[model samples]
Target: MVNSVNKRGEKILIGPRLRRLRTSLGLTQTRMAEDLGISGSYLNLMERNQRAVSAKVLLRLSETYDINLSALTSGTDQQLVGELFEALRDPALGRDRVPKSEVEDVVGASPATARALVNLHQRYTELSRRLVREEGADEAASALQGTVPATDLVRDVLQRARNYFDPLDRAAEDLHTELELRRTEPLTALIARMKDHHNTVVRILPNDVMVDMLRYYDRHSGRLNLSELLPASSRRFQIAFQIGMLEQRSVIDTIVERADLPTIDAKRLLRTTLANYFAAALLMPYGPFLKAAEALRYDIDALAHRFGSSAEQVAHRLTTLSRPEARGVPMFFVRIDIAGNLSKRFSQGRFVFPRFGGVCPRWAIHEAFASPDKPLVQSVEMPDGETYLTVARRVTRSGGTSSAPSQSFAIGLGCDMTHAKRLVYSDWLSGNPMPIGPNCYLCEREACPQRAHPPLGRALAHDERARGLSQFAFAPDH
Candidate 1:
């Protein structure tokens, strides 16, 4: 039997748009259910595009929330297709049995697979990193040795950006004056231009509106939806992006070019990533921001208020302070959610993340979900005996901010012990080690039960669980 289907373009937008609306009203699945008289799962499926947002429900949303019909319809786009493709490209999909085309077809036609696609893609990333470690031994060795190699920095810089799209950045450095950033501050001036020139909009939507994460950018319409409740630290970063494109467009392009990304998609992502970099730089200009961070003791909130940034922004910017000549503090930064997903991550090698996933759930950042907005800091050590400091706080993301139900998620941030000392917030790290870090396979903690895969020199305990110090005993990599 032929399956009745809506246009692919329509389905994509409907899902995210429904998500945006449900978030705006601060309605949860249960809450939205009570209002729309629909089951939570059904509402979820609809918002996720597992179920087409039916005309009847759409009408109710438009009527009840006074949402524009066009906006609802506008949910359809190429982004979902891109996200799906990105997921399907995952080398881990069905352990490699499923072909990319098959995954694509299913993702385009079946909503369940679309959801599943994210997991499959994340798995792919994990596996690929493993392969990179094994095959990229030379690169890894070079990274550890602090020796510069061809194309190595290229990968790191691109990865730091998480491969997003931004068209304008460094190309305009000389033309900074053109954008009014030449004589003035790049970051501050960039923000001015974003508001006045590109029609790029920045609005701190209510905290309740966006529950889970820090920043959301709508490239189609050029809108930056920020969480109003986010610590001043992060909001400022988002504001910078809004301004950066208008001011740093040329600079962004230069970075994108020099980076020499392989795919158009990667290039696009890099553009936005660099723009974000500019934004953070503006709030905490390299030199002064570093001085304030040092003086304030890296108190993220205080620094945030000083620089008008959010915790996430402050964490990310801390990594950029590594410019050798005027380096502020050299620290690594990582962001992970309760689901154990490392959504946003960057490290200075001073703090190492697992090449894989399933971070130590015992960490305070993992617990941040229980106490939103409160920041947690801990000093920890690697199996190699390298000590580091970790800072964590719960960050929220809002789904269905338009008319459907919405939800929230939290992530963790961390770095090294020495780096922590440089941070205004390092006072918490003066004590003993904490259970903050990634899981086995990547983390060489031989004692962890969450070791989905054993670390490099570990032997399977087999029956040793009944007798020894650990089930799977690990030998040192050295």
Candidate 2:
């Protein structure tokens, strides 16, 4: 009873929380007071915690606002505790006033203080980030004057451009009218139709003719020389890019300019990327495709058949279901070569997977390489106890019609387990099977023998017991 009633223990920073909630609810103190059946001054005092929130007032607010009191209270308190922790991270203060756990306890018990702390902490973080970037820029610029190398120029552009498209982005928008290509899937049906309409002969050329080349464009004769080893998907992409380079050069340039991309290299890469997007768009038009996916419960094979695409294509298309009019199953899609090289990652959903290097071996994505030709769907449980539903299959990558050897790649589609029921993979979760793994960054399971690298955010402490079962015998709690 004492702990529950301890006012000091409640980390209530209610003033900011009250103000935020009032703003969110679109209410002034007078209106809020009227709603609460209290005087405006009394309402103001309550927000400041000069007046304790009575049980009756709390109940009324909960009912009136259509919110759970515990939730509103805890949310604010957690935000506050986080701010306090961030402040405490700066070891300048001699900290003996209150125990950290007690401070956390108060934050949990009291809602108001937590909200203020979070708000304050966020502001501080932003200021700190700005200061660091500004300082770094000033010092670096001063150190290297007239001789700003190409690498430095690239860094400047990347820094200013936020590492995404610039003029290229605007070009993509402008090209929508000219090329009529969706941002994700860029190719038009007309382009695909031209193959039959114009008798566009797609010849499987010898790799020896264009060694280490993906596609060669001969605009004069309208010939698309694709490496024979390229997969069907690759061949189509190469052909469409050939079209983009040949016909859609203007649109590609517009996107490059819109994104503020450094041009000398942009002409080569951006055009190809936009062309592939156009091709993908052509295969899976947003509206009809997403509708089909929802109707079919996001079945990859069904989508592939409907679009005349490969399983890998369907998985890739799953990333772009973000259109306002049409949305499909939102999942993270990845493609990895047999050598474990990450070829592509299409992720726009909530989660942020690593952008560089290899993924955790323990992840089910690696399993596709082992069982080529077999499509698999598995319910994955990460080392950190996070479970995910993953759909994986092995796909072969060819160098087109040429003798360029094809390399096998594994395509994986996954979503958080909480979102699994919405997918067509619930059936895979019912049966029990051995989990195969060795994911370095994704696995949090300390006991995993296959973990090649420690998870990015985990810390390990060396324990006296040397014969632990896991690879890194150190023990640390997240």
Q: Of the candidates shown, which would achieve the greatest TM-score relative to the real structure?
A: 1
lDDT per residue as tens, model 1, 246-334: 65676678777886655465577767667766665555556567788778877777876665555666766666665545656556565
Residue ranges of candidate 1 with Cα displaced over 4 Å: 1-129, 134-155, 158-239, 398-415, 429-431, 435-438, 456-459, 464-478
- TM-score of each candidate structure, all chains considered together: 0.57, 0.54
Candidate 2 regions with alpha-carbon error over 4 angstroms = 1-214, 227-235, 262-267, 382-386, 400-405, 431-445, 455-464, 475-478
All candidates' lDDT scores? 0.59, 0.60
Report model 2's TM-score to 2 decimal places: 0.54
Highest lDDT scorer: 2
Q: In the order shown, what is each candidate's alpha-carbon RMSD?
A: 18.8, 22.0
Candidate 2 per-residue C-alpha lDDT over 235-285 given as tens digits, one digit per residue, 9 for 90 to 100: 656665555455556766676565454345544455566666555654565
Candidate 1 yields a Cα-based lDDT of 0.59
